[model samples]
Target: MANSPVSPSTNDDSAENAAHGKGRPTPSRAEQEAARKRPLVANTKEERARARAELQARREKARVGMEKGDDRYLPVRDKGPQRRWVRDYVDAGWHLSEWVMPMMVLVIIASLVPNVTVAYWSFLVLWVYIIFAVGNMIFLGVRVKRKAAEKFGAERREKGLGWYAAMRSLQMRFMRLPKPQVKRGQYPE
Candidate 1:
């Protein structure tokens, strides 16, 4: 009777597709409102546990992606062929900047010594080493810019790319993210 010619049924498409239900009775208005309402803070242990598990899973996925150099998982700063090339270039060769950190530690220790002469000399040597290190870093930055410009396009290059390369070079090879695609002395062409 509902499907009579005088009345159009909503299930007219039933011939082409079967209607599927939630398999549970429809929720009441009060139940819906109650479900919609949640405390400002989750007081339930299950909620906290679920949240922690989700956060851990997200962080783990990101870490693995970062280590693998997966572009989708990488941060905006690290996402690009040019950045990868810079990382590879830096990792391929030992840089003066790498030792600068250890030198800085030594200098700090020497400066803490009771002997004024020792402190003075250590600071002086440190200043000289720092000057050389800065010079070396600048040289490397220029080389990175030039190489990247040649490999990529000069017009397409981003500003401060040289600085990015220089900073990456300062980090110890083993500590680099995306884990050094090139071996020492295997500089990218």
Candidate 2:
């Protein structure tokens, strides 16, 4: 046994390791980290300038795509077909609350009038309009949620979708992001 070059157990272990590649040496933590590390800033001025230009180009591309509502470049919140459909649905219809902000601005300007009668009237109008807008928003939210659930299924309906749709409805048609793919009165199927 002593004269033999390798023991029986050693031979069996080597055979098992060879079959599995388990005998190969593992990398050290530092070596692994070093391999992973990359220089964010390029070494040369020209290289740095090129990197910056490339980054700007990418950012511009993303901005254009996002504005166009391109699915590949859309944010996680706006990525899905359901969200797009919701936007289209909201855009195709005119909601009373869409004028709320502009009306509020008018109210504010009216309140600043030197005449006490005008200011008082403006305040009264503002309160009445706010109440009406709130009710309109509530109705819109309910309808949007119902439609979303019907089209996408209750399980597929995303959290905050109701609020998202309601908010989009509140914005002026021209001001909404991904710029109203569907024209007014042209609701998606």
Task: Mark the 10 consecutive residues where model 1 has the least summed lDDT.
Answer: 12-21
TM-score of 1: 0.75
lDDT of 1 at 159: 71
Candidate 1 local lDDT, 48-135, one digit each (tens): 9999999999999989989988999988888888888888888888788878888989989998999999999998998898888888
Give the alpha carbon lDDT tens digit for every residue of 102-161 in model 2.
988998898788999998898898889878887887887888888888988999888777
Clashes of each: 0, 0
For each candidate, give its TM-score against the true structure.
Answer: 0.75, 0.73
Residue 86 in candidate 1, Cα distance off native in Å: 0.8
